[model samples]
Target: MDHATPRVKATLSDEGQRLFDLFRRPQGRSRPRPGERAAMEGARWGRLTVGDTAVVTYRWGDGARPVLLVHGWESRASRYAKVVTRLLELGYSPLAFDAPGHGESAGDSTTLIEYRDAIVQLHEAHGPFEAVVAHSFGVTASFLALRDGVRARRVVAISSVPDFGYVVDAFCARTGLTPRLRDELRHRIERNLYPGEADLWTRFSVLTGAADPRPPLLLVHDEDDEVVGPEQARRIAAAYGERARTLTTRRFGHRRILGSPPLVAAVGDFVSTGAVSGGLPGAEAAR
Candidate 1:
């Protein structure tokens, strides 16, 4: 609970001009934790310009068969070091980036539209991708980009956020915003975040769309996830039906699941061969 929440709740009805600013901005950027520095070694680092913002990018191994790795909110590309290592071993190039306001990127705040635009630009440079691997909020951006015509042979969504409303609801719950303030925040996000998109809520959702023969999607989630919850994966699995394969794990929760050795290998296998090599421990597959 940073100082923003209480202050916003206190002054929201008065000097509430920047009420949604904290919502748009991540509270803090993530860094490579100890023993995580090696995960980023031997990568070609560069920057992609999206609407005048410099987004730091990473590419591992030869740029042959490219797979996009999208990290969640308050996370960075280095978070995928283990997966990157596995992908390289499996002969798939892993491409990742620090979304505008996260990691070593240039911005104080960012939006789903910004994330989608960055993905589209990356696709223009290194797509149609072999596969897409995303976590949490990144899953939302990936879905929006796919809806907007980004192509990939397969997708891996870990602890996915199913829609924009879930994001808002979760934030309000965590920040303890008043009901009145929460409703106002939602309206402000709709009107100001990406203006003129009246259908932003429906269009950005994974639950409302049609079954249009999307790429084979692999959905991984923790049964005990404390951040995004297991229902998000269930909803996506139900919506995608036969097109989506789900794997449920325990103990790893939300973030640690990213670096789980078994999970990383599963992702690599799914990306390269379109299947998991060995059945994961405590894994449950949903139809």
Candidate 2:
């Protein structure tokens, strides 16, 4: 049952429904602060036009091996600062881009399709990435890109949502939208945001057959993650069978997992050597 069902049932109205839609749309985008901007000033920066949006990209190191860093929703490329540094130390170049509607990109709203387009555009421009390291919602977009033929030797998904339905469920729970209103919202999203695609959710899901021929995947999730539960990671690992490995952390939670030294090392090791060793004590290996 949705936690917000009671509140939504009590306050159901046309205006409330509209507000819920607006709330579901991506917002609260963060820009690089002075320190972050200064830190990234030395990196090569540019923009690529995808459809009607301009995505800002950053490049660090000049190594032949290129790694793509995909940040989550409401986040920018700079969020991968520590990971980029580690990758550079491992003799691999790191490239990252701000998705449209976030960071330096131009747009107020974006969808998974846009995210996939941006990834494809980046691949076309600087690709055949050695590996793609994606976090949170970016993992879904990265998986979709891989499914649609973007080439990457390996992938690291941290704090990932296993399916698109989880996002829908979370939105409904947060907004206290009743099942009826939730259905209406889904219909409106299909009609307005994704008119041409009838099965957007299924198409976007990482666990679905859409993401076939999975790359060597390193699935990392914090046991204490409040945003995306650890079960999502386990489910994804199970879905990928022998092609994936799972790592669980204790105190890292959701966002903090990104900055964990051991996590960073594990990702770097996986990308560079196709193996990860000496992780946190309780880290579980799946297949």
Best by lDDT: 1
Model 1 Cα lDDT, one tens digit per residue, 60-95 = 877899999999998988999889888888888999
Give the deviation of candidate 1 from the true structure as CA RMSD.
4.5
TM-score of each: 0.92, 0.89
The per-model lDDT (C-alpha) reads 0.86, 0.82
Give the Å shift of residue 73 in candidate 1: 0.4
Clashes of each: 0, 0
Pairs in clash, predicted candidate 2: none
In angstroms, the error of model 2 at 177 is 0.7
For candidate 1, the lDDT comes to: 0.86
